[model samples]
Target: MQSLSGKTAVISGGAEGIGLALAKGLGALGMNIVLGDIEAKALARAQEIMTDLNIPHLAVEMDVSIRDDWQHTARAAQERFGDIHMLVNNAGVGGGMGALGNLDESGWRWAIDVNLMGVVYGADTFVPLMKGHGEDAWLINVASMAGMAGVPLAGSYTATKAAVVALTEAWSTELADSAIHVSVLAPAFVKTRIHQSHRNRQARYAPTTAPGPEVMKMAKGSAQAVENGIDPELLAKRVLEALDAKETYIFTHPKYRFVTDERSANIAKAFDSAAESPLVADVAEAPMALGFVDS
Candidate 1:
């Protein structure tokens, strides 16, 4: 994982924003790039950028939510570059804004499918291939700081990202003995098009109800925050540094460190309270509930 030169990296959502920045940074390091994106126009633009840089690359129009799309992307990468050394699960969407109960089921499904399941599909499809190479590799799953500390009016998006964080932690443990290194990138707002992610919403997952007043207010504020957020290229540089350092958790925007610390401190306080409460003793003495065992 220390050396990136001559490595091959397959990055989903690589047409624009942070993904495109990552492609540029990694390509500059002499790594072969394979860009996958749902938008054909953006993919074309990304291809042009890569071409201009004289970086060997392949652009594949791919919907990360679709398993077949991932399979095709993997095959294309293998065919173009012998062994995959990096897999960047960067595709994600900003789900509908509303209270948890007020949000449409479609919104939840769309967020989970694209943000969480997309990473799962990428890892499942690529990990075996990477393992076969028997060489050092890296897997970067892009989550968000909102996942670390839940944000109001963005429950679905936060939930999906938090799940990604947990999954990456588990994968890090499971793949500890292997050459594939797993890391989750938890970044704060960046100057990306995620605020306009609704433009790419699938028809089936379209929001059924208009956002409430609070949701709309939050959306406007979030959009403003993103407009003034950190640059994507800066994030890409940090990601490359993390890879070289083999860091498990890659965070951008250190200003948000207080928020993460507050969340952790609150959880720790709750744990302390539970440890001192009589309820803990009662729960420990309670009989375990039995469940059906699959045979």
Candidate 2:
């Protein structure tokens, strides 16, 4: 986990942005790379980038949301490289931006499937393989700044990432005694073509001709944020540093620490004041809107 040298790592969504940046960093550390992406053209570009670096790699087309796709990707990685020492569940999307109440059922399902269940599928498919590889094997899941903090507009995306963060935490706790390490990357805004790419990818995978009217509006808002975010390379470096530290939560922005601290303090105060709390009996559960349901 300290260094990626000689390790065979499978990176989902490795075609561009943070995913490609992480692949390049790992490759520079002398790790063999297996890059998965649904976009053939972008995957080709990614392969070229790795080739320019003279790194050993294989770019495989994969849909992380699909169980069969994940299985095939794992098989392809094993066929090309040996046992995968690390699995990076980095493939994700930025769906149309909208309030939780406005999100459609399809958008909700898409967000949950791609952002949450995709990580689940990746873990189910690759963890067993990683587990057999002895200690030091790692699983890295990319969440977002919204994962820990609730953003008013991006309800679905925030929800999915929160799930990812929570799942990674539980998995880490469960596997603490094992050599396999589970970490989640919770980044703030990062410069990547994720929004456009997600929209484009969705178009390719969609069973319909085009998205609905409301969905298009959401997608546009998301694209704006993606085009104006921070650098992916910096996030990539942070990811490597976190891996070196064997840390569980890899936070991108230092400012986020304040938010986390405030949340923790509020929780502690609430616990201490539970007896005097006024609305404790009204708590109710409902299905959460998550992921990139915005687009």
Candidate 3:
């Protein structure tokens, strides 16, 4: 995983934002690139950028939520650039922005389908192709800091992202013996179109309920925060560094470490409280069963 020269990478959502930045960074390192996105114009612009850089690349119109789209994208990547060494599940949507009961069903579906299920589809479609390639391989799933810490008015987005983080951890263990390494990128905030993700929302998944005033205010504040956040290019560089190091969890902003620490501390305190219960010793001595792992 140290060297990326001459490798091939497939990036979903590669037309813009963090995806495009990663494409640029990886292409600069001599990796053949396959950029996939739902936006045709943006894909064209991405291709033009790669062409200007003289980087060998391909741009494909793809909707990561659709399994058929993923299948087609996989076929295209393999046909254009032999075996795929890296798969970046970067396509995501920011939807379901409201309180639990106030959120729209469509928004929940959109977020879960794109952010969580999309990664699942990508891994299922691409991992087999990457195995035994006689070269280093990796899987990078773009999650968020919201996955680690709860953020108001972004419940569905946080839920899906947290699921992605969990999936990445599980995949890392499952693929531990294989050449394909797995990592989850949990960036706090970046100057990306994710704040305005609704601009690209599909017609069928449009929200049925309008956001409340408080929810609208929170969304605006989030967009402003993202507007003043870290540059995508810098985040891209850091991602490549993490890939080279084979780090499982990649965090972009150090300032958010305190938030994660606090979350972890709260969970530990809950465990401590549980241990103090009268039933603690009996529960501790009982055999624990993990569905995915055998003792």
- On lDDT, the candidate that comes out on top is 1
Judging by lDDT, tell me the better candidate of 1 and 2.
1
Per-residue lDDT of 56-107 in model 3, one digit per residue for the tens?
A: 9988998898999999998998899888999999999897798767868899
Pairs in clash, predicted candidate 1 = none
Model 1 TM: 0.94
* Alpha-carbon TM-score of each model against the true structure: 0.94, 0.85, 0.96
lDDT of 1 at 295: 48
lDDT score of residue 101 within candidate 2: 53
lDDT of each: 0.91, 0.81, 0.90
Q: Candidate 2: deviation at residue 130, Å? A: 0.9
For all candidates, what are the clash counts? 0, 10, 0
- Per-residue CA lDDT of model 1 for 1-295, tens digit only, reads 4668888999999999999999999999999999999999999999999999999999999898999999999999999998999999999999867886686778889999999999999999999999998899989999999889888888899999999999999899789889999999999989999999988898889788788888888999999999998999999999988887889999988888998899989999998898888868345533543332234
- Which candidate, 1 or 3, has the higher TM-score? 3
